[model samples]
Target: MDIHEFLELPHRFRWGGVGGDDCMTFPASWALKCVGVDPAEDLRGTYRTREEAHAIVDNYGGELAFMDSHLAKIGAKRVQHPETGDIGLIKAMTGETAVDQIETQIGAIRFGPLWACIHPGGIRATPAEFVAVWRLTA
Candidate 1:
């Protein structure tokens, strides 16, 4: 799918939503598509809740650590400036948890200055300054 189609993918709270929603899955799925991988075919049934997300991050030490580990897993590297198609580990002032705790989100760069992913109202673009970018290693 092209950027427009990817951006138009339905948003939901499910872990790996083809039509579901969640921060990580939305962009993670998109990143996989950039590499010619289908998330529904490869990444299925994982990180289904806020607690699960926290546990996974705690397992790797913390948010940044988890992001690093994840990036490494996908062969992506941290970048000072993200271009289109780069992944971003975003730290927004807002987060979602069943118990009202904070959380982080992952999104893909759709263009200069914008990181696109599933937000509360649906898929939207956030400022690149709001995230730490990671690009796939060449």
Candidate 2:
């Protein structure tokens, strides 16, 4: 599917099933699918909580490091600007406070201008001024 088609897809949040959409699953799935690549059957089930997800990145050093590692793993190249089909890595508050401190989440850029993310209600769009974009390479 093309970028336009991908954007037109209905957005929903599912923790472990890839039926329509989810934050962690959508960007990679859409990017891969756009190029005729079938993304993993299940990109869920491993990490179910914030702590578990954080641990996955912590194991690879930190957020940026984890992104770097994933880029290498997927053969994707980091780009300075947003393109139609590039995946965006973003940092935003998790809305929960820990010891009076706010936690942040790293999510993908499914689309831009108004970068979209999955939320409990549905897809949420945020400004792209602070997101990092990457282009997937075959």
Candidate 3:
């Protein structure tokens, strides 16, 4: 599916699940669609609480490191310019939103000028900018 179709997917974001995963899960889902592989497969459905999620992030020394390690498996390359459907890291360490309970960094997808993230209510546009971006090489 293309980014436009991905945006229309029905969702009720959850702390952990296959399709309804955490904040990063949203963009990670997009990456899966792009590459036909789940970079987060091992950790999905393994956490239920914020604390458990944080523990997983801590295992990798923090969110950035954790994501860097996982995304690498899918041939993710860091890029300065973000394009539509590109996955990115949105810095939330400053406590920008309550959705950031794990590693203080959330995942978002570039859709035009806006970044899209999965909110508890559903998919929503994020005001937070992409501090780092990755393009999947498949």
- Number of the top-ranking candidate, with lDDT as the measure: 3
Write candidate 2's Cα lDDT for 20-80 as tens digits. 5545566767656755453334345665655666676698787667666655566677888
Ranked candidates, highest lDDT first: 3, 1, 2
Task: Please provide, for model 3 over 1-138, each residue's C-alpha lDDT reduced to its tens digit, 9 standing for 90 to 100.
Answer: 888898887777778756486786777788888899888888889988667877988999987888888899889999999888888888644323667444457888888887887766677775665668889888
Model 3 sits at a Cα RMSD from the real structure of 3.0
| Reference-based TM-score of each model | 0.72, 0.72, 0.87
lDDT: the better of candidates 1 and 3: 3
Which ranges of candidate 2 are over 4 A from the true structure? 16-22, 36-43, 96-103, 110-112
Q: List, residue by residue over 81-130, the lDDT tens digit for candidate 1.
A: 66777777776544555576454555445555677766666766766454
Ordering by TM-score = 3, 2, 1
Scanning candidate 2 in windows of ten residues, the lowest lDDT window is 34-43
- True-vs-predicted CA distance for residue 23, candidate 2, Å: 3.4
lDDT of each: 0.62, 0.62, 0.79
Alpha-carbon RMSD, candidate 2: 3.5
